[model samples]
Target: MGEEGTAMRMVLCETEESRRTYTLNSFGQTISSYEELCYIISGQYLYFLTEGIPEGMREWIEEELGLVLPAEEETKKQLEHIIGYRNYFTVPEQRMLVQKMRTAYLYSSVRKHKMLGDLYLKHSRYLSAYHAYQKSLSGLMQLKTKEQQEVLYHTGLCLTRMFRFQEAKEFFKRSCRLKENKKCQEAYFIVSYMHGDYQKFLEDGRALSFTEEQLSEIHENISGMEERFSGSEESTALKKIDYHRKKPDDLMTRRLTWSMLERWKNEYRREIV
Candidate 1:
């Protein structure tokens, strides 16, 4: 081969390799431009993902930069939502769109479920948040252990808000078993109080990181509840359940928890009044 012809062939070969190393996939789909390479390399793609892109911006990204995203229907819907609402509304407002996006495919998306759970929690919709987090935890395609502890914590918080203290206590303990945090410890104590396990709480709580002031408040609350119910029964002041105790199945446990939740709500109302 002539020198110039050989040099041109080498340049073409190097360009193809550069594309593969930078933006081309195994199937040979190439990102259109050097800007796409820059975005991928700099991690700025994440920023665009969070902020979302307008139609004009999307066109610019595709036409000017040649970065085509995956075109899956559910993914497109989610991406549009993520990109469409930048500086327009609070995330909670955007989260209402979850109900709109609740097709089977979207429901199967853990990211969607988790986003909906966050919005539900943000608005104090504990029941909705609980189920959403549960769905995310049990996602079929990929059960992410990375968020399991957080899911446990949030699910426990939801149960606590719903007045299902026993279940809440159990979930918090599960989260703590995975990884301990002060919030989880305090929440465990709070649920223990609600579960009427005051003795266990006081004994075990001493080892937790609650401030002395918080501990004093808990003591006062426990004392009041005890004084009022001392002659009634010591259900909460007793030891924790034994490991061999027969736990109910999910459906039965849910039914029982719902039944108990109603009673607790009435009791809570009476106390407040």
Candidate 2:
């Protein structure tokens, strides 16, 4: 062949090979080298490189190739798989899988931690849930919305479950201050009462307005606790009214204690000459 013809043929062959690399995923799409490298980092095509490229082209694939699909889809598939069968794995295996799932950059960090918190709560892992909710709050609490309120409330609930009412009160009060919700207020009053701060609940409870439904609910809790306390004769058990079941999430723990504070605030009076 002539030198000019040979040079032209070599150029055509090189172009065809380049086209093959870009079209490897059969997505019928082609992007710049920059975009392809992005695909590699996203891990959509990392495995494809080892299998698709010839040994001689390994360097080129590493430096200039790409993945072809959204990493989120793969992440979802993995999550689904884990949900379907992770119970079969040991605790360490589950932990490793969960940690691996957290590395999915496409997923929101708040959502990741919230889901982790929910999963932990499902297993009655209050401590783990508290930690997860704390992490989520770091990212979400600044929004000062219902989601933030819920996370703060959940954190308080976790602390309350662990018998850390003082710490729980801090979170519950913060949530109430951010947005005056019925739940946060009730939780705050309850936790404050639980921690032996009757003065706060009595002094603050009356000033905080309540919905008719909330008032009715609070009254019911008061009546129920009165009956329970009246029925018991054990003096040492005055503070242990939550013996039957869960406390923080239950209204009973706060019921007996809160009722006493309410009575003191409403019926009692001081006179000055």
Candidate 1 residue lDDT tens string, 1-273: 676656432111111212232222211224444433332322222222322333444453455544554445344364444333333333553354433433323334576666656655664556667777877776623545546677788888877656566888888887776767778876776566554444566655665555667777876764565455433323332222221244533322212133334444444344334
lDDT on C-alpha atoms for all candidate structures:
0.51, 0.51
Can you write out model 2's per-residue Cα lDDT over 17-126, one digit (the tens) per residue?
23434343322234334334333323332222212332323334434433232334543443333223313344564465455545543446685676566655554566
Any residue pairs clashing in model 2, and if so which?
Answer: none
Cα TM-score per model: 0.39, 0.44
Query: Model 2, stretches more than 4 Å misplaced?
Result: 1-105, 142-144, 203-273
Say which candidate scores most in lDDT.
2
lDDT of 2 at 23: 41
